[model samples]
Target: MISEQFDLSNRLGRGDRTALGIWFWELDRVLLALILSLLAIGLLAVAAASPATARRLSSADVSLPELYFFYRQFAWAVIAFVTMLVISMFPKNMVRRMALIGFAAMVVAMLFTIILGSEINGAKRWINLGFMSFQASEFLKPFYAVAIAWVVSWKLKDKSLPVYPIIFAITGFLAMILMLQPDLGQTILLSGICFAVIMVSGVKFWKLAALFGMGIGGLVTAYFTYSVAATRIDAFLFGTDGITHDKLALSTLSAGGLFGVGPGLGERKYSLPEAHTDYIFSVIGEEFGLLACAAIIIIYFAIIIRVALRLFEEKDYFTILAVTGLVTQFCGQAMINIAVNLGMFPSKGMTLPFISYGGSSLWSISITSGLILALTRRNPFMHKQGQNRRYNR
Candidate 1:
């Protein structure tokens, strides 16, 4: 029996006519390649930034290895890769079901986090899971996007469902919860995802304009009402009581003008905080240069464009909306991280997706990439048949 099982697995690996084989052939290979490329780049970036972070955290009594974070990040990347592949193999219905269920679970987890979570950086966002500290909000993002998309797409089936108000309530409630955690970055991101999905769902122009105006107003309110936001904004605008991370990041990022100073040779990264997480982009810029940073941005644009092209011919409203939400969340986070590193935006503790060194972030982003893969999976044979049937009709 063992030998037979091994043979069957080998056959599947060899691309035999099995479910795994079918998935291998049907899933979007180009997008998969792009995602893997980002993961690979992430490992390299982590390796480059690990020494600085490790040293910074080292104490007189306990010394950390230079590559400690890199090693752990590598392990997380491997696990996250496997998770992405497995989730990508799930069918569309399964994906939707998973997102809905996961969203509920994450909401519960967020509630628990609010009550019993450990505080980090003066925020109660992470809950201890014995072996690891899990940030519920980080994992909530992809699920929230899919859930919102699924709920909003109901209008296509029945226009009287009041989906808009339902989504608004959900978004508002979640925003309230996130603000209580004082995670302004996530609250802003969640709002952006909600707005983008509604806009893409063909909502009225007036509503979009109203939402945009409200978004601006919300920023103004945050600046006044949220101490963290107000401080960061004041620092960015007037350089009063500014954080050192942003200044160090800008200096490190510009140290390698066009071509990098070369990998592992950046001295400025030593003083840059969160070098392996929030400030990893600056490390990349210092070690790999401005050209490398531009390349990373270009790769992000490629992934977004690739997804957009894939959705061009999609007929399912839910798929279009879900994919749009996921992509917005993914790319939006990356844009924010890069913007912060470049001193164009206030520091928001956002991680560059698939590039930052953190277990929760890696897992969350991997699940996100997996959902995108699953939703966008195309069976050429079925697609052809559907077209033929439409022609016959």
Candidate 2:
């Protein structure tokens, strides 16, 4: 019975005519393993942070179960993985169409959020449905990347099109809404994704420089105008009490030394706000050590490198651009989250991908993983047959 099951599961034929059959045969297994490993580590990290988080919340009469966040995060992980699998089954044209529709819906939702969303940490970024609060920006990112890549690919195919200007206009509109939400982090993050797509699409050097200058100028304006940005900058550069989180994160990381204090035995996590969400990396450091942190970083880098390597030989412009944008956004968010934990950058309140205890972040990142998987999949037999045909010719 086990042999029958294994045979049924492991084999795929060119004659097979099903979506699952194609995906099962073509999906990049190494990339999937790396992502699943990160999700597993995230669960462990959240488990470590749960007691402290629960205690802190319960003290304020928030009344959560001791492992509430961990359990919820686990549930989110399941949903995220399922979403990724379903999305990966979609064909390229369908993915693009879906992204178009999803982007429009998210834009409308974001506008509504700006008007009626719940305020958290002095930022209005979530729309509270009766069941849960959803962050539209989290869901918007992958679709936004797809939409931008689609537009840029069109310009690549037709030189007469005024593509860069259209990109700029859309970016400006989106940036305006994001800044109105006062989410400077996401505004910058999405801008980086767009810039990466533009860069890969081969825009003029002067135009690229102008975009970079605009980004810098936007940062300056944000630092001066928003107290949140200003406070983080002041804390990071001038040294202020506002850096309690940063200081705690660094000290805890340092305290862990080479190895960790052991899982669920972390002390400093109790004092750090958002330990389960934004600073879970530090919790991992404190419990599992710098070696584990390094391993995590390497896995993230490996995934990016693997994706880029797969796309190196790809001839499809849309596939290359869409995957590039998605991977850039994925690795970019991971870098920002880790940088803030290490005190290398100002606090951004961005959750570590896969590892952070947030439903929206987990699900969004899973969608990104699925997109990468679908775009990178190449049929082994087709590749072999192409090589054979070339040799014969």
Candidate 3:
């Protein structure tokens, strides 16, 4: 019946088609729609934002080739969609194993970047391969969630391996690479994901508290190892007087106001160095207005809350960790972008996920979201009926 409601193009939700149903609370339609919506918006945002990039690079006088960025983005969107659908259709066990393999591969790739990678904007974060370049951090997302979730779930099952040490090892290894890239923003985000997974998995509050303390200590040690990192952190918090990137982002956002200045009318975007990538949200706010920005935020929060709500009902430990970690990373990245936009935080060369432009960011985000989609799909009526049966007594 619910399948009928959503107009099932193919049989889903009963048995073989079970994974396709949107109404299933476990398969939460809203979340599915949200991910799809983001994918669609990524394409649209790329189309909208690319002309500005064209003008900036080629000057208004010269008729350059059709915007290069959007065409690449459109291609990536298709790949991302295929990736998401394929991941979603997978069985739970396969998803876990894929996570393991994927996570390990990304870790290696991330380290490899540090030693034999190209420098972009003063940081050696991307592993460039002549014709193409990819960021290991983006792929690190889903696989990291999968691997940690497995550890957490396994610990719940056997109660042997301690969570913190496992977390510390991963954290330290990746933190080193990120530091080499001089990406403190990513380092902080990774730490947050690990902390979130541990806490939500019911690790004792005392242990959680201790982990945070050690995390802070490790970061201090890191700062000493890398002066560039220490300076970025310091600059973010207490920079000398100047029209900083973060401040400029705020001005771009404020200039958009509640009703936006209309598309192609963003003057700030032309001057903003990372307009098409890192600070793309500012461009969205500038051209589409504050209301559009708020709408985007609301949609993101809704999907996150939807996933969290589902996790609360299922007793599976891995699912709990996987879902929570995914949401945390998703929201954490978005929050960082927002904070930087609002002047509450310093710039952190991060994209606004689906909304921001860039082949790497878009591809990585799309694939990661696919993992979340797989995690949340379920039979809705079955869950609802069970709830009714239990409460109606």
Candidate 4:
């Protein structure tokens, strides 16, 4: 969106440059507030879920503090905030380039993961750096969105599916690695983002249909071709696998109705698996009640819809597709997680994006939202009185 005025440098000035040489904008304030709001929700959800988890993992002699997970998450939140601020200050081109670099790096990391990564929990999804594991799939979601947005946005005189194969190859390669992780969840999420970008590009329907066919074929391969995948899907369908965690989550949601049992008074936390990670929404339902859960869902929808509504005000294709990909994937995954919670879908290990309590995912998603803000920040003209009135957002 900022590019409309890029050539007219004399017409616009980068907002007060800092020692870091980064600029600022009015949109930054609004976007930052939204990001922080998600963090606040994360903190609240973690507070409700962590104590129970900690007790399970702790010894009776060593009683854990209520703030154990909360403090660690707070620290990560602080780190993520700084990371977000630094990214937000960069120029639009710089933002795009940085995301491209991240995408490229994750591509290479995924390759290495296939060759030499450890397989844990039956999914080879992590690269061990001695001290920690890096989930390349998680880190790549935002980057891939930006990279694809940057790639597809060029108004090509040639209407052909120019260089799209390369994008698909890279995307497919990443999906292959996640499938190796046996992580159908991430693979599906990645595909959803890819689909959103492709659809928004106004590409021919035949191309979309072909890709859709290929994607469904790939999922079939992932399920039947890979033993781990086949096992999970089979378990999901027959409800007969050694794995039986999702039912607990559904039960938890059923327990929490209109008003929730009130926070911290949850009985389900003790029995529900991943109470703080993939299934935190279930806890919200169980303790806070369905009304509270609905309120959380409303927050997520508001964020996604609010972002999508403003894309037309963007001056460039990159911003539109990038925001579209990011928001679409986010809301899509959130819906699936909610669906699973409601027993409308099979158990899928999908985390509730910003609200999940894992280490890397929260940090990565915060940075991703920061990138979206950086890319989608409205130009000064877009926010002017007349422009806002005209856009009708």
Candidate 3: worst-modelled 10 consecutive residues by lDDT: 16-25
State the lDDT of candidate 1 residue by residue for 1-393, as single tens digits.
Answer: 999998877773534668977898789999999999999999999999999999999999999999999999999999999999999999999999999999999999999999999999888999988877899999999999999999998887899999989998998899889988889999989999999999999999999999989889989988889999898888888888657668779999999889999999999999987999999999999999999999999999999999998899899999999999999999999999999998999999999999999999999999999999999998777888988999999
Tens-digit per-residue lDDT, 24-54, candidate 2: 7788888899999999999999999998898
Candidates 1 and 3 compared: the better one by lDDT is 1
Best by TM-score: 2
Error of 1 at 341 (Å): 0.5
Q: Residue 18 lDDT in model 2?
A: 75
Candidate 4 local lDDT, 1-393, one digit each (tens): 578566456342454344332345435455566667777888888889897778777796887886687877777778777887777766688988888899889888877787787886666777888745777877888888888777787645455646577678767877777776567777888888888888988879999999899889987877778776676567667887676667778888878678878889889878876787778888888887888777778778778767866776666766788888888766787898888777776667777876777767777877787777776665464469766687896
Clashes of each: 0, 0, 9, 3
TM-score of each: 0.94, 0.95, 0.89, 0.86
Check candidate 4 and list the clashing pairs: 257-290, 260-288, 260-289
Off by over 4 Å in 2: 1-17, 60-62, 389-393
lDDT of 3 by residue, 128-226 (tens): 776568888888977887788788777766777776578678777887778877788888888889999889878788988898998888778866876
Which of 1 and 2 is ahead in lDDT? 1
- State which candidate has the highest lDDT: 1
Q: Give, for candidate 2, the lowest lDDT window spanning 10 residues.
A: 10-19
lDDT of 4 at 254: 71
Q: How accurate is candidate 1 locally (lDDT)?
A: 0.93
How good is model 1 by TM-score?
0.94
